[model samples]
Target: MFTNIRKFSAVVVTSGAALALLSACGGTDSASMGGHDMSTMSSSAPAATAASAQPSATFNDADVMFAQMMIPHHQQAVEMAELADTRASDKEIKDLAAKIKAAQDPEIQTMQGWLTAWGKPMPSGGTDHGMGHDMLGMMSEEDMKKLADAKGAAFDKQFAQLMIAHHNGAIEMARTEQSQGSNPEAKDLAKTIEAAQQAEVEQMRKILKRL
Candidate 1:
């Protein structure tokens, strides 16, 4: 699934957009929170406007963490996909890899843009993925090297298995964001990631079965 970008400002802006979008959809029964009438709250807008507050402009700590962690996670996936171009022999595997790369590369940029717009520093420094091996289904450097060195049927099989595992990790993280996140855009993105990765996971399993 393709993701839409939002101008997700910090916490304050997110709250405002929630208010505006809700109001736009139809008035709320109680336009207030914690004794404050959000309808009359009259707070100044964040640095961004509603037009810009897309893909994500309002976010909470959960959204921030989701973006921060997922950035590197998606990056690693892109790296693995790049390797598939040469290493994979099966046409379906190659096409899937290409699709994964196309989908995730822009998502990396979108998340990074959210972090930057929110005034958070993107994880600094090199090719280091900065995620645990089991924490988010990341493969070790050794494993990546192994995949890179492989070709033909061996490469396709290993890639499908590893990518399935990797997609599962991403789906897990995305589910967390959906439940715990405040930014509408971020939550929607999480849903997109979850659905897309789940579909791909099943696809990969079918490919593996054939191999």
Candidate 2:
């Protein structure tokens, strides 16, 4: 009788264990069937957080200064180009001014975008950082007045001379940016400006000689 009792107890324990396992399996299946999607839960995670974990590009103070100063300097060039188009009598001079205006205006927009993205303010006119008075071939008030008042061959000659000086200044600024700027985009722009303005300088010199 005791042996039979022990056998019955073992059978009961095995049955209980099997029921527990069966309940666990049923719960898992219910979770799956009840639209509890583990895969979708993982897929819905924010990717921006993962992206934000990556390193950002670095820039130095010189890079900031270059962008700040050049924006205004390019603005001045565009102004001068507009003036030349209005006042210049020579077709070549007018065409050149128009081209300069076209090129620099887009570049100004690009630089402005950079400043905005970098959280820097647009350059103001009042501050003087000793970047020299001749930033990007800008003429003094007197020189601009002279250009405005001159006419015919005189205007053409003066425009060429002024433009050459202006292009040279742009090249100098671009070189500085190339040497000191840490931002890759700024450095690339500087290189482009250097190449383009250098070419313009040569063309202006030829125009001056012809005049």
User: In terms of TM-score, which candidate is strongest?
Assistant: 1
Off by over 4 Å in 2: 1-57, 125-131
The lDDT of each candidate is 0.65, 0.57
What lDDT tens digits, residue by residue, belong to model 1 across residues 43-121?
0111112212235555666677677667666777888899999889999999999888887776777777778788876
- RMSD (CA, Å), candidate 2 to true, equals 30.2
- lDDT per residue as tens, model 2, 1-211: 1123223224323433554565567633211111101000000011111211112356554455566666656665676677776678789888878877777767766767777777766665431212233423545556766877887788888888876776676677677666756777777777777777777777788888777
Q: lDDT score, residue 160, model 2?
A: 82
lDDT accuracy of residue 102 in candidate 2: 76
**Total clashing residue pairs per candidate?**
12, 1
Please name the candidate that would achieve the greatest lDDT relative to the true structure. 1
Error of model 1, residue 177, in angstroms:
0.2
**Model 2 lDDT vs. the true structure?**
0.57
lDDT minimum window of 10 residues, candidate 1: 36-45
